[model samples]
Target: MSYLQKPSYYTISLVVVLLLPFTILFASFLLPFSAYLRGPPPIAAGSVVAGGCSHGAADGGGGGGGGGGVRPEISILVGVHTMAKKHSRRHLVRMAYAVQQTAALRGAARVDVRFALCARPMPPEHRAFVALEARAYGDVMLIDCDESPDKGKTGSSAEDVTTGTWLNMGNKAKNRVNIFPRMYDFKGVKPEDFLEDTIGVHQLKQDLRWAQTLEHFNVTWLDPSSKMTNSLLS
Candidate 1:
C-alpha cells in the first residue's frame, strides 16, 4: 500500500478533449437561441437608423424634400376699360407689362392678372391693346360688365350691400366686365342693361383701396399722366 495514487495525467487530458467538442456545439446553438429566448433584439441600433431617417426628412431630404420649394408671393389684378381714352389705354397696357416684369423679378410663381372692360362697343385700338397685353402676360382674364347682373351700377356700389354682398358681387361679376373679351368669353356676351354710376376721383381711390384689401398683391396704380418708372414697380 503506500501513499494515495495520484490521478493520471493521461486521464485528465482525455476528459478535456472529450468535453471540447460538446462545449463548442453548445455555445454555437445557445448563442442564437439565447437571443430569441431573451425576447427582441436591442433597439439601440434600430433606433439609430430611424433617427437618421428622421434627420434626413427634417433636412429636406428623402420624400419630403419637395416641400423646400418656394411658393408665389403676389398676384395682380388690372382693371382696364375698353372705352378709356387712347392715352389711358396705353398707360394701362404699359402698367400691366411692368407688373409682369416686376412679378418675375420678385420670384413670383404666378400673377393673376385681370382686365375689366366695358363690353358696349370697344374701339379697334382697344382690342389691339388687349391682344398685345395678353401676349405680354401669360395669364389674362377679361370681365365684361355689360353681361353681368351688376352692370350699370352707380359708383361701384354692390347691388346688394349686405355682409356677404362683396362675395356675391365678385361671383356675379366674373369676367362679365372683363378686359380681354377674346381671352375670357368665346361667345360674345353683352353687358347687362344696368348703367354704371359715374365714379369720381375720390370714389376711384376708395374703390382701389377696397380692391387692395381683397387681393394678396402689392397694389401699384400707374396714372396715365405719370412717367413710367421701373423703380416704382420694383
Candidate 2:
C-alpha cells in the first residue's frame, strides 16, 4: 500500500487476465449485432410523405430521431357530435396519445390540437363543463354551426359533422402543405367526379385550404441538435 507499490501492478494484471475471456465472449456477440444494426444508415425521413405530400426537406427532424420538422401553424381539429358530462374520446385525443402523427410527421415548432363542436343548444351545463376543460387545456375551438335537428339532439349541419380545419401559420414558406382540391389531379387518382367521389369536392376544397394556410407559416425545429429523421404517420 506504499505510494509506489509495484505489487499492485501484479494484482491489476491478474485481474485483466481473468476478465479477458469474458470480455472476448461479450465482444464476439456484440460486434456481430452491432454490424447488423449498423448495416445501413437509415434512409433520411425527408424522403417520406406527410399528408400525402412527397417531401424533400421538412424543417423538423429531417426524418430520424426528430422526424420531419414542425409546421409553425399546425391545427388539428376533431369534431364530436356529442359532448358528455364525462370526458369523451375527443378529450382523450387532446389529452392523450391521439393525433400524435400530425405533429410528429411535420416536425413543427408549434402545434395546436383543437375541437370544433357546435355551440348551439349544447346544455348550458355541458358548455360550462367544456369551457372549464378548454380553459385548463387551451385546446378547444368552438364552431357556431347553429343547426339543431330533432329536438336539438344532433346539433350542427352535415357539413359540420367533421370538417377539415386549419391552424394559422405564423411565418411564410413555399414548401408549406400545398396538396389538395386538385380537381384535375387527385394525388394521381383520376376520379371521374371529385364532387361525388368518396372525398367530396367540399372536403377536397377544405384540404386545399388547410394545406395553403399551414404552408403560409414557417415550420422550425424546436430543437436544433436532434437527429430523428423519420416521423410516425399515424
Candidate 3:
C-alpha cells in the first residue's frame, strides 16, 4: 500500500477475480426477490376496462394487448333498418354525440356496440359500403332478411334477422340492451340511460299500439309521463 508500491495489473486482476463470483451470486439472488419489492400496484376498477377502441382488434387479431381472453361484458343490439341505399339516419347514428359517449363507455366498461341490419338485397354499391364499415369497425351485425323497401312513403320491411341470429347476438355478452333505432338519432344508446342512469335518453316501450298503414311504424308514449321532460325530447 506504500506510494512506492504502486498497484500493478496482477493486483487489480486478483481483486476483480475475488469479487466476480460474489457479484454473480448477489445478482442471481436479487433477481428473484426484486419483483416482490417492485411488484405491480393493486388492481383498480375500470383501469383494465374493455375500453371502446375505435379498433376492436382491427388487425384481424382476436383481442387487445392487456385485455387478452376477456369477453365483452355488455352487449348492445342496435337495429339498423336501411331505408335505402343512402340512409341518412344510419349515417347520423354513426357520427352522433351520443355515439361518442357510447364509445367512451365501451372503453371504460365491458360494453359492445352491435348494429342489427339487413345486409342482403342491399344495392351492390351499398353492400360494398356495408362491408367496408363492418371491416373497419368491429360493430354492426348484418343479416339476410327477406323484406321490401319503401318508395314515396309506401311499403314496409321487417328487420332482416333470424331469431337464432338475434338470440346468438344476445348470448354473446353477459348482459345486453336491445336498442330500437329510428327512434334515436344515433346508436348512442347506453346501458345507463335505460337500465340504470335513467336521466338522459327517453326510452319507448311497446306499451303503445301501432297500425299497419302503407308502412309499419312504431308508436310509443314519451316514457315517464308524456311531459317531454327528458333531454331526448328536448
CA lDDT of every candidate: 0.41, 0.44, 0.44
The residue-by-residue lDDT of candidate 1 on 1-234, one tens digit each, is 545777689988999999999999999999999898889665542121212223222212111111234645543343333332243434444453444354244355333333444444556886676555444433223444553335542234543364246557667544334333222211111233111331111122243443432232333555655557555655
Candidate 2 lDDT, 1-234, residue by residue in tens = 586856678898999999999999999999988998889566765342222222322122121123344434544323344444444545544432222336444444333344445666577888788776554554454565653554343534553332322122433233444335543323322333333422112232343543432223222222444444234221
Q: Highest TM-score, which number?
A: 3
Model 3: per-residue Cα lDDT over 167-211, one tens digit each:
678785445445553134212333322223222233222212111
Model 1 scores worst on lDDT over the 10 consecutive residues at 58-67
TM-score of 1: 0.29
Each prediction's RMSD to truth:
22.2, 20.1, 15.0
The per-prediction tally of clashing pairs is 23, 20, 4
Candidate 2 lDDT score at position 44: 61
